[model samples]
Target: MSKWSGVLPRMAITQRSTLLLFALAWLGVCSSFTVIKDGASSLYFCKELDCPKFEEKYNSTAYQIRMYETSKWVSTTITGLDYQAATEEAFMKLFEYIEGENDQHVKIPMTVPVINRIQPGLGPVCASNFTVSFFVPFKFQSNTPKPTKKELFINTLGQEKVYVRVYHGFTNQTNFPKEAADLGDVLNSTQTYDKSYYYTAGYDSPFVSHDRHNEIWFIATDK
Candidate 1:
């Protein structure tokens, strides 16, 4: 299970209310993907404050899998499932694992981008998304410093054990575009990364510390 799924209830309602306001006011919140009632392969969301009800196709096998996974429900029958079936099973297993999510391991943030929707035409064409990952030991305190790059691992076993050092910072102030471009140039020049449509989200590190995380994640997608 992705860490972001676990933080909602623990969050102060004030923050949630604020985010709700942001979503309704700024058109900035990422839409929640939900199942349909007796429908086919599809997902939908309520984009307005007056959204009457969460409507979906309940009979969709895909929707079942989506619910089992996103709602953190799982079953052993999910094993050996392929394609859509496999997705549901995987979500079930992950959801169960996330039930025991501890603060020490899960570091969900206030906002999470699905990645595939934000920056399209980058995923599948090259890498799924150019996510430049690195690690900062807990000793870094609150001071940001030059980060060292690390290889990211796939969740082939479905165990996401990333120990990210978090930080806090304001965006749109630094030369983010230049930094991203520079990192892209380096990654492209070295071929350390599979491709360059994405970038390293390491800029806020030197400003924020390892103890606090204001992760700068870039979204890559295939439209």
Candidate 2:
């Protein structure tokens, strides 16, 4: 028998029910897709074209300014998985959804910097309440396909300018916050950025090492 099969029978009714609900929720998020509205464009990060437009390269330890265009995304909020595991799980599920596992049977190209943000006011930032998003390519932005599952949804982000700090090396629960705090200090000294909410963008796959790129973005509220 499967590992879960043996443990599930021994669980209390309430525990069993909770586990079942969580599993179902994850399934829904992984499988569902919603129809795109008219005139709503989808957007993706293309290093050859779009990335250069938004992100300006710099040679400072402080921050660089980036102007991002509004874009649409497919995302799911997972409550129990840690940063790495959540990202991995979310990506696979989204990949499957786009690979004809959804209601639309559409295959979409993947984009860079799979976004991971900590949900605001969600107590402390640990494993729970992390949102993982995949950018929907521009071709499908205007008329996006829907997911087959219920827990997955689409969201639109408005255009904004932000201050970003790029870093190298692998990210984890410990290092992420530390780097964020360090960036926060740099921004605090400049008094040029608004730190209300910051975003973490990862550009490389787990396999890539050496010149990996990761960034912390703080929205510019001064403008």
Candidate 3:
């Protein structure tokens, strides 16, 4: 046997060990502090993809309180008499922006909870205002690309507390209002939140027909 044969095998083993250690370290750095196998956010139905990071401040059978960090989102408004139709139109507009219809012409990864702020009309015959928004992926939050469409723009939501009520199955015009009303009923009498406008959040796609998750968010007031 050559004198250097043993040294060669030892060197190969050392190289493998260093590579393994480096990989493990890389993973540790990539994983956020709030993420874990069974963390609060993981169990809160943000399992499939990136989502706005939040700290669960309170929980109960009726509803939960989450303090969400300030984040930016791409949003567009649609006004119509029917909630379903307006929301559909708004979704496609935002979808196009994410599908490379922006100045950068870059495709951004979709995120969870397609949230819509609904400002109910004053009268039954009036059109309601629907603002559909998609969370900007964390990587692009700092410098979001400008949308090609004039109506679409990026908006920043400041750090705020929200009362969230989780629901299952599909959300539509008929069901979301009912769900929001139910949530309002369950809230404590002393709880202060915005009643004029509420957010409907969908965490799954229409194609995902089962085990879907949705939510109604009432912005908690400082008072």
Candidate 4:
């Protein structure tokens, strides 16, 4: 409320706490998340109202990773960050919402790294550019049963991007055999892909397409 109240000694989240917050926010599916700050040295924030903002100061000062589970009960992975405004208060609400969703148990994960980064790409696509920011990388092994406690990463990367795409059908529905084969030709055709550069998988893009199905992507990043 007051400047003193705003600047109180109440700022910071562990990596796992970050994830718990994420799960609550994503699952609730109300608005967007925001990350903002006064300056690189200032940790205090003034969130917009209903969305998540970008805060470089958090990235520069935080020393751990923050993450949360997207609690959206989607029939599929085709979702997007359809938010309005980004503000610190909005984020506090988001985190609080997540805590409320969790019954305010404060049951955070054990492996949150100090300092966080986040670069949320728009909708439905699984693999995101967490590495692009200070957020910890989200690791979802294809087809593996969801972990009882998945690690939520923090934003460490200072970039955010918005892209769109479209999907057509179920993973094993159409002539995927031929499609995979074609894509393979392109990857191998290049002057030898640095096999170690990434781990390949099936994916679906969320944009516009004649078909309606889960999109797959060959996600790649660095260690």
Cα deviation at 100, candidate 1, in Å, is 7.1
Candidate 4 local Cα displacement, residue 161, angstroms: 14
TM-score of 1: 0.22
lDDT for predicted candidate 2 compared with the true structure: 0.65
Model 4 vs. true fold: TM: 0.23
Lowest lDDT 10-residue stretch of candidate 4? 71-80
Residues 73-116, candidate 1: write the lDDT tens digits.
11122223122233222323332222333223432111111111
TM-score of each: 0.22, 0.70, 0.79, 0.23
Better of 1 and 2 by TM-score: 2
Q: Please give, for residues 111-154, the per-residue lDDT of candidate 2 as tens digits.
A: 55677766545556444666777777666677878877777778
Error of 3 at 77 (Å): 0.4
**In model 2, where is the ten-residue run with the lowest total lDDT?**
44-53
Global lDDT scores for all candidate models: 0.25, 0.65, 0.80, 0.26
The Cα error of candidate 3 at residue 192, in Å, is 0.5
- Best TM-score among the predictions, by candidate number: 3
Candidate 1 Cα misplacement greater than 4 A, ranges: 1-119, 122-154, 157-168, 171-178, 186-188, 196-223
Q: Candidates sorted by TM-score, descending order? A: 3, 2, 4, 1
As for lDDT, the candidate ahead, 1 or 2, is 2
> Is 1 or 3 the stronger prediction by lDDT?
3
Error of 4 at 100 (Å): 7.0
Q: How well does candidate 4 score on lDDT at residue 52?
A: 22
